[model samples]
Target: MSHLSPRLMRAMDVAAHAHRDHRRKGNRVPYISHLFGVMYLASRVTDDEDVLIACLLHDTLEDVPQEYSEGRMREEFGDRVTGIVLGVTKDDSLRDWRTRNEAYLRHLAHEAGDESVLVSCADKLHNLKSILADHEVLGDGLWSRFNAGKEQQQWWYAAVHKVTSRRLPQIGLNGEFGELVRVLQRL
Candidate 1:
């Protein structure tokens, strides 16, 4: 087994516990598996310890209400990891999801040199890869959840492409991710 620092191991354990009963859309696999997938991908792309930890904890603030506080994250994992997680979490109350997404992407672009960007890119890449895999199995429903609408979809597609092209050359286009980008553009 790969050895992780105590802090990182604790973050993974906390996220796993928080997401214990949850399952991914369509597949229904234990949601912690998704977190592990993201971290694994990040480890492949970058050796940054903070990025790996952030990937492990990425969904904790967004999906787990009880552990969503910034202060709690900071206290447990320190400011850097908490900031990265916070940077990626969406505000569901926003009336305009596209605008919120755009803002978040823009923030990621600005933070490109930070470990947060690596973590966020890994998270998005993992999600896009899963969608592509599900497309192979579930077909249109995968597109439906992601498609949203033409303008929103186009904006996200273009935005992610722009960011990936600019910031994530380390995670080069390959395998399912390349296909998913093509699928997004076709939508």
Candidate 2:
């Protein structure tokens, strides 16, 4: 935080406020904590300010209402950041879980680029980490938070790992995505 640039610092503020009332499913922790994990993991993959900012605000589009959509994100951040947030956001209109997950994967495969995948890579990593950690304690009860069950959740993670790993074969970082893939594959 003390080392972050002004642009990224502002993003942190926006994410904290936007998710002020949201809590994590696993332990009911503040949602901003998850965003922070994603931001930190994304930072490991790249120092690009846009990706880091997007990571912090990635859930904003998915969790916040239309009035607080990317338009506000654009005003607070910029088009680049707004676009990155939008890129990672799934269309909630698709009520069916599998359909929404599949469509999101397809969208990432076709439309999302390396930067988008970078944010996604960190996102998946942190999410998988939470799922595993909570599952260790809460066991199967943790799956209740997600629409997809254990098998389906595993499938999505594996699929996203394949696409994102192929898109970003070599991040030259500490292998966060690779570690995530390995960990998720073992599950």
Candidate 3:
């Protein structure tokens, strides 16, 4: 048996349907792998069920279409899980990549709470690891798949690392975040 909590299994089911149409940028990989990676990392750092469930659903509100509203999510997953998803959700109406990312980093710095950062850190760590892996094979071509180039991508990850790192010490999960930051820096 896989031993997943019933709540987590339900979260994964919802996230799978929500992200069903999406694919990773550089390859044909399903976006669900990214979600699972975030969940795996977050589960490693903390046993909090809400955190784990949030990790699975983290990208749903941001990436999926209007299939699931925040209210609907709250109805399905409760306040804490929905709140984490909303906290990590970006303002999508903003036009450009840099502008959106800058706004998100700003929000992380000024508005987001520690629980929000905890979930966001796992998502960023998984993304940076994918970027590093794709960079190995795709080289400069990999940057073309994303909204920004290598330098801009690196900047965004570094920025998230900075904001997320400060929050991690308080949560006592600083080492994992630190290691992710170091790997991101090296990449």
TM-score of 1: 0.83
What is the C-alpha lDDT profile of model 1 across 112-176, one tens digit per residue?
44566666666766777676677678766665664274456555756765676567555653333
C-alpha root-mean-square deviation, candidate 1: 2.8
Predicted candidate 2 versus true structure: per-residue lDDT over 135-173, tens digit per residue: 788877877887678788888888888888777878643
Mark the 10 consecutive residues where model 2 has the least summed lDDT. Answer: 172-181
Candidate scoring better on lDDT of 1 and 3: 3
**What ranges in model 2 sit over 4 Å off?**
172-182
Cα shift from native, residue 114, model 2 (Å): 1.7
Candidate 2 global CA lDDT score: 0.81
Q: RMSD per prediction, one decimal?
A: 2.8, 2.1, 2.2
Error of 1 at 29 (Å): 1.5
lDDT of 2 at 105: 92
